[model samples]
Target: MRTTETSSWMKQLTSSSRQGRHGHALHLFFTRLCLQPSIHGLVDPYPAAVPTALRACAHLANAASGRLIHALVLTRPALASDEVVATALLDMYAKCGIISSARKVFEEMHVRDLVVWNALLAGYARHGLPEHALVLAVKMRGLGLNPDRVTWNAAVSGFAMAGNDRMASDLVCAMQDDGFQPDVVTWTSLVSGSVLNFRYGRARMLFRQMVAGRAHVMPSSATVSSILPAFAGVSDIKHGKEVHGYAVVAGVEQEVTVSSALVDMYAKSGLVHEALRLFDKMSERSTVTWNSMIFGLANSGHCPEAVSLFDRMLREGVKPDHLTFTALLTACSYGGMVEIGKTLYRAMREECGIEPRLEHYACMVHLLGRAGKLDEAHDFIKAMPVEPDCFVWGALLGACRSHGNVELAELAASHVRTIEPSNAASYLLLSGALASAGKQNEVFKIKRSVKRRRVKRLDGCSWLETS
Candidate 1:
């Protein structure tokens, strides 16, 4: 029976090859070749066969098909003992987002291999369980199973994702001590992880190390994308340009993800013109690309240009999502484009079919308040479909400051105080508004209330760059 099954499986592979069905059809043929019961008790009933079927299930993402493959594996005696087949099971379950089942397979394996350990580590790492990945890595070491490059990458990446940079650095050091040369992935994680914690110094140091090393491990597109945000945070246009040059030399300048990051970097560094240049040269852009541009403009106080770009985005048939509305509303508030803001806010629900989130309402309050429509803005907040957050009340209080309406200021101030009683800015705004109205006694009352609460203003500091 085993011989007959081998002959049939060989014939199927041969027939599929000759008939020019060597792609999907061949995959299906191999899939069925694993499930025949005639060879169930063969010395190696389902090693290669089961792995191939598991690959098919991974491709199809059909849990039912995966379970069918597992059922076949269970029925075969020798097949269930193959570590390769078990790794496939772990991989299939992990890729299907069924981490629990993957863990069960791992725990049940009588003699788990390094590949099995790596699969579980990778599964937990990918599923945002870095702690679990770390614990598993420790267990794998305790069981005397030395980790390979892939396993090390999984463990390092897990710590990096969880913002545990100290552990990530320690892992890298340990890998180096073990004579494992860091690959592109390891370097990428170090740079990206450091930037995530705003540790630009460490990020740049590792980047320099990668460049200086003779191993020829070039940075990937993800590496460039990761480092770009660090430059943005520091407003370091000089370093940003240097990195951009490296990206150009590496021939990744036109990549949409990297280009989007570059645009954001340039914009945040107060170089909107450079950002626009990159935006125009980008061959392809996603919704995030448009969003970065809009948000960049809004943040830089180029509110009119930001609003104009939103219109152009619509004209170019790019649909505005929730972030687009938030950006547009910010532009409107900052630029005092009250009418345009109202129109955009209405069009959000009517034309775009995107529900206005709380941030959108906050923008409306800011817009109305900035326009001196305090009464209307207050009413709008009261009628909001969602509960008003601190930002909404903050906007109303700001409007009170602008209009010098003590009554409205106190009302807005009271609401903010209820939410954040110790906020110095809220109390200060209330006091100043009353004082501006010649209500000195009322101002003293607010100050007394502040004193009784022991609220103190936080000192504001500005940094001056030194050469």
Candidate 2:
């Protein structure tokens, strides 16, 4: 049922998906292979490309496309029964957030290998079902199939990411008892999970141990990216630079993930010049890399440059996501480019089809509010398709305080209270606006309410250098 062009598409897909790229670039490249070819009869399926195509779809989270490939694969007796194709199909289903389909595929497999078991185990681990991963591990052992390093690593990564440090450590001990010492992958998983869960201190300790040869594992490119965020979050340029040095020695400084994280680190830490220097030298740029540079520029008050860089990103044919829009909108808001912000908000939804998320909405409100358009911002919130969260209300409240709109400030603060009742921020904003308006009685009332509610303001962090 395949035409010559379709066959060529599969061949190209087979070759292209093997390239060291992930996300939208790979997704767009393989989308051509997913065109539904007519299969009303015995279809001669391209088994070689089928697995690669499915893997690429998984990376894109394109389940619909994967299902179409599945349909095509099912049409061929050879592909339907091939273990490699079946494993790829199952892996695709699992990663595409279709766990039920993945399980069904596993059940139907006449012979499930360690790879099949690990695929299913990893699916459960990565998808917030660490318990399922453990249970499946036990099930694997019961079936006389002991889990390998990959299996244990997947389980460990899942629990670590779920913020269950005790269980993840227990698994590591269990793995050692089973005569499989943790590898670089295992350490990287732990580091990544710690960073993601906001345990930066712990992440740093682990990375130190990793590099000290405790596990005899050198930090890979993944380990570099994972550890960069831990340093970035704390503005620890000293440590970030050390990691950067390691990356250079490791020959992964130009690797996209490492490069993106480095750019993000320097940018977030207020070293835009260093970040820009690295950004320009990268041979390949992912969306994260571009977003980081734009954000760095915007935050450093180079608003026009941020917008210009975003335009360049579009010119380079890179797909922009919601974060991209948020950075651009933030630049517009900070620079008082109200019209440009509105134009971008419209273009995001219309041209890019990125539905304005809560952050996007907050950015737009911030833009309008900072421009002294309080009534318009209030109207925009009322018109939002989805209910605004605390950030959205807080944006309006902060703007109200800055622009001295006590009445609208009261409304925004009340919404913030309803959303995050314990947060002292909204009440403080309302009090500030009332104080600015010479309404001492109103400010006193807010202070009394805060005391009555026993709302505690968290200690604020400063980005000032400790050195």
Candidate 3:
């Protein structure tokens, strides 16, 4: 009784999801076919539509809508019993971070195929439970379900993502022993995991291994994107350009993620012009792409251009994310555009509905502090909805030091020391402020206290006197 063929409605759903228009897909599922019926009567949508809709929910991480779809599936006897529908439901819950709910769906399935087993195994593995994934794999074998490449890759990805390179490598060997050749995904997982956990050298080595045909796997778009960030982190633009060339040779240079990573690598490596050129050439841009371009412009002191890019993004109907606002605020701060920064801060909350995070508040403090609005910056800190962190207070302290406001600098330093007792930056800033104010005796006292406490200043924790 399972509907196997793709219907027109299912095609529409699939197309939207694949195109990354997940919100439109969710709307179609919820309003027309999922929650409400057509004007004709109680409409039974094509069984395939359910899976497509569930995948859309997975992409959007909308578990509530996924549950409603689950309800609809249950009411349809055919869909409830179909293995495809059940597996889709399990994947939706898992991808949405509801592993327990995914487990429930798995247990309730009347028939479990290899696909079903892989779904649950991946749910455990990718959700930071590789041990459980391994255990599940063993149980599957005990039940006579041999693990496939997909199963092995899922386990590898899980361990890699958790930063356990040793365990992930062991899994790779085990999979090889089981006669499943490791592919591009396997190497990419290792490279991505190394980068995610700050093992940049390991990531670069793995990427080199791939390029040298150590595993007979050509670097895929994903592999390129995964390794680019490592080079970007270390500012190794030499290798970054090499990878950009590799992307072109591999024919994935134009892929959205790969291109976006290229933009980020260029920007972070101080090649804002190169980044912008690639950015402008891109036909499709994701939020990461725009964030990279904007942040690069801001950091490179092209503040006006950064704001202009942001406006272009909005005019083109691209939604601005939290990082977008962060980049804009950073531009305003660097350029001393207080009025624009304040207006955008208000718009971020009122228009975009993105609740201001700590970084956003810190950006505001930095903006005000940079513009010499010392009293206003202090007032903003006092009125913060959440408790101010060291960074927020640190911004004020740096500004106070620059302005030689000894009293305010003392207040700011006290708060920083209270929050981060080991941070020597505050002491250095206070001393610098005292020096600026011509209070050499106070500066000597501060330096003596720092020495007595045996507070070793972390590398690069220097303060400049501006008074």
Candidate 4:
């Protein structure tokens, strides 16, 4: 019943969609094909066409278009009952953040495959419903459906995401016992999960074990990138350099993610020169790459270098983002470029179209406060469109302490305490401010208050490398 032209169009669209070219052109083509009247009058779209359009909707996160496709499928019972079409619909809804709709589609499916189950499981994990995903995994096993690598990876990742690294590790072991060896994907999930749960030391150890245990399965660029943060956290330049060496030998140094992680690791480890060198040598750079280099330079006290790099990034036609502005503003704050900071703050909205986020406002507060503009900073906080957070107040308090402004310090400390009652930083800063101002009585009162709240100060520890 299909015309040759209609069949050709569907074939081309399906090919393009499979090749991951699911953009506006594909969306428009599909829409036109479905609406076009054929010799028989209303030509029902090919069953393959439905899944392709659904894929485009998933890629674009276009729920409205997906709903239209769903309606079309509903009118054609064959397409609705088709497993592939049903799976695509489920995936589209899941990706669009409509999990309830995806579940309904799954429940109504005439027959389900492993692919469909995995899709639903991944959807649950992606939406932060790890417990639901785990429960579903149990049900899958109860039906005698053995989990594949993808399923095991999802379960491990889900548990990891839930901050249960212990359970995640246990699951990994269980997966190995079930005759499924932990691959690079499995280890990567564990490493990233450990890092996310603040088990940096464990992440480092796992990275080591992964290299030693899995000789055949070499670490991917993602695996290398995941472990770099652990090195950065502890300033382990020795371990970081070793990872860098492996990245170079593995020919993944050109990968934007791996390169960026290497740059960030070196920069945070107090090797700004090395970080800059790596940044310069990168053949390709992403927005994240630029942000990392700029942030590194700014945080490492190379304020002038950071600003210079920002200018070059602009000259190279790389669009600046919020993080870009944050680094630039932070550099201005540290370097006492108050006028420049003010100009950039205004340009954030007017020029770059980036609305100031809380981090940007915090940096601005720090900028003004560091320049001894206590009154101006206070007025600025009061005039902010968004409510000032504890970081803003803490910045003001730090400035008050530096300038010996007892009254302003007290006001800032009160706001800090109200926002974060048990914040040791607030108590310590307030106590320091009062002590500096010779208010012995107030200092003693703060100490007693801290003790009464049982707020223990976190220890100040620094990473030291021995030659």
Candidate 5:
């Protein structure tokens, strides 16, 4: 009967893996099963069982619950010795922020299988330690452990996320040379790597090959997701349409992953109307779907629409994350809605309990400065919890240049000089401001400063600096 209930629990677990569902149902089911005292002695034969439950804990980020599960696993002497349980134990520990414990489990797993290695690699990869992940992959290869799809995919995506497409490309070629046929995931990883490294043309070429070859392999939702960002980079509406046609032919348009990609592709193409239209037509929309629309609208100059959609999202009880507010604030900036931007910025902290990250503050500064409210923008910068970076000052200086405000230009120039004295743009802008004020001597002085800065930057190229 306990086994029956466990089987039932597994069904409920996998069936509702999608986000925004009743996750608590699965959580409760696992809780009931794990709490029973009789199951405590079932560890030896049921070592595989607790790991699945712990996975649910990881997914929900229930650190306390994961700890409880980890404790339970540790108490089972026979279960603790199982390799499968040990790997899941590491996964749970990593997810729960017990990285040290996870490392202990990883080290203890003698005769670790590919699954164990992949899990550890994925945990390291997700925690922003791609170097550790790569090291583990090398160790696995050295151990004569033949890697499977999951291992290759994790390594490739790990490199892609780390912004090292060259390494990722090398991995793909290495996989191919080892007689490993590239799958949709492998292709997606390469395309994603290209996009991250700003090699959109190469991404496009690979994408085209995938389509033209009509290789028995079908593109996964991951493949579509990876290629969509590249389209945004290249602004290739033609190729985007072809991909869209393929998606429809493949019957994956209804898949949330595919839909999210489509939304992003249209949005990045500057076809705001088309993007909005596609968004409306989607049968289901995830947070990612909404995020893509919001970002696209904000970037494509539909600032008002983006803000309105944000409000609609709140009304619909959809929780907004950092990316969500970033998009909303960008909308406010692009629309020159300084008052609205200020209110939104405050609401992020006061009402939503979300702290304003750097991007949000940048957008806020951009809003105030662009609207000729330079003093207020400067005050906001001074009052920020974090130190203002060069981009923040650059935005203010750009605004000064745009408005031809000599006083603000000088102040912004001073800040820019501290941040990047050698930047030719600052000198040029200072000269423009001086010229705007009809200070001919000051303009010449700024020009001389620029020339001196340029000459001082080069050691061997002195003869070419006569200008």
Candidate 6:
């Protein structure tokens, strides 16, 4: 016996909730629904209303509001018994970062399904409890619940997060053996995991397999974005262009993430012009998009272009973040535009209100040091609001080496050793400075120190893929 007016209001609430408005706004709408007085006073919401309200709570990450919805559902047996509502409640709690509460709800559910189990598994994975997630996956199998693609994806991601790439790859094999084909989500998880663990070679191999349609699934935009770093790592411009061609054919070139990755790949691979062309063609750009282009231009020695693009970004009303200023300062430092760097440093605080971070300070120190202003660089380090890191001291030492200032080099090297005792770079730089100044005694002392400390120098390696 629903009144037409009440039914209309319910429909409007449901529609509005599903319209994908902001979480807070949806939460307010749900709150209004709870407060609305019906003929019998504050009426119980419809069972269908529970999921939408719970979603709002999840979006806002508001556990308090979620608890209220839980209480409301408890009073209505129909809503309480609804599996969809129960699953939504479980997901909401999990997403709100209340894994224990999510587990409690999962345990209380009378009708647990694979979706419910996956939700809990993803909760553990998301909360950095990959071990717990894997154990639960085993228990889930023991209970005769078959793992689906989503389930395996979560498990793969969990292992990846745990830095167990071997186990992650084994799981993919097991997934294939279980008559389940890995989808884009599956490959993306593995690819990103490999990247995180610094196994870029294996990541590129995986990307190639995905592109060859091993699983009979096309690579998604995320898949393309994830593999760009591998090409950048090896500077494999050939493979990068191949991927770029695929993106164009797939019509995903306009996607912000893919475009950003393309720009970064081209820039890192020493093709600044190609990167610029792609940046210019982008119809829409995010802050990251601008940062990537500016960083690429700067990194590739086009400092003037980087500075000009920063100006254009400002003119277009796009806000520059800390990374933007860091890139801009880096370009000025490398180009010997000392005055421009100083001006931008001041404007970062006064105009943009961004507090100078350690990276920004490091760039400034490097800039002044590279320009042979040893005393100014030293003063800048002393004037730092935050403590100067090894990078600042190292910059000063390198500059001293260049300027043949043995005394200042010794001082900078001492500070650097104090900050990072085992770092071979500091000793090597000091040795170079002493050797250049014909101080054979100091150079011998540095060599003895290196031998005594057993400091191993990290080897530099580059990769090139051949067809």
Please list the Cα RMSD from the true structure of every candidate, rounded to 1 decimal place: 7.4, 3.0, 4.4, 3.4, 5.8, 4.6
lDDT of 6: 0.85
lDDT of 2 by residue, 11-39 (tens): 55656666634444345444544454545
lDDT, residue 389, candidate 3: 94
lDDT of 5: 0.77
Q: Write the per-residue lDDT of candidate 5 for residues 1-467, one digit (tens) a residue.
A: 47797678556655655443436644654666557556546522244456666676677767777777667667777777777677777887776666677888888877777877888887776666778878988888898997777777778777877778788778777777877877887777777777777887788887777766754567777787777776664336776888888888888877888888889888877888888888998887878889989999989888899999988888888888888888888888889887888888888899889987777877888888889888888888899899877778777777777778888888888887888777666777778777877889999988787787772333443312122
Runs in model 6 lying further than 4 Å from the true structure: 1-113, 126-128, 462-467
How do the predictions measure up, each by TM-score? 0.74, 0.92, 0.91, 0.87, 0.83, 0.81
TM-score of candidate 5 relative to the true fold:
0.83
In candidate 5, clashing pairs total 0
Tens digit of per-residue lDDT, candidate 3, span 1-467: 12333355566777898888988988877665545444445457677678888888888899998998898777777888888888999999988889999999999988888888888898888889989999999999999989999999999999999999999999999999999988999999999999999998899989888778557688889999999998874347787899999899888999999999999998987889889889989999999899999999999899999999999999999999999999999999999999999999999999999999989999999999999999999999999999999999999999999887889999999999999988899999999999999999999998899999989887763233233
Number of backbone collisions per candidate: 0, 0, 0, 0, 0, 0
**How do these models rank on lDDT, best leading?**
2, 3, 4, 6, 1, 5
Could you tell me the lDDT of residue 150 within candidate 4?
90
- lDDT tens digits, residue span 109-208, model 1: 9887788888889888877788888788888889788888998898888787667888888998888887787899998888887887788877877787
Off by more than 4 A, model 2: 1-13, 21-42, 233-235, 462-467
- Candidate with best TM-score: 2
- On the 0 to 100 scale, the lDDT of residue 322 in model 1 is 99
Q: What is the lDDT of residue 451 in candidate 5?
A: 80
lDDT of 1: 0.82
User: Which runs of model 5 end up more than 4 angstroms from their true locations?
Assistant: 1-11, 14-22, 29-49, 57-68, 75-79, 92-101, 122-138, 141-144, 160-170, 213-216, 233-235, 422-424, 455-467
Clashing pairs in 2: none
Worst 10 residues of 4 by lDDT: 34-43
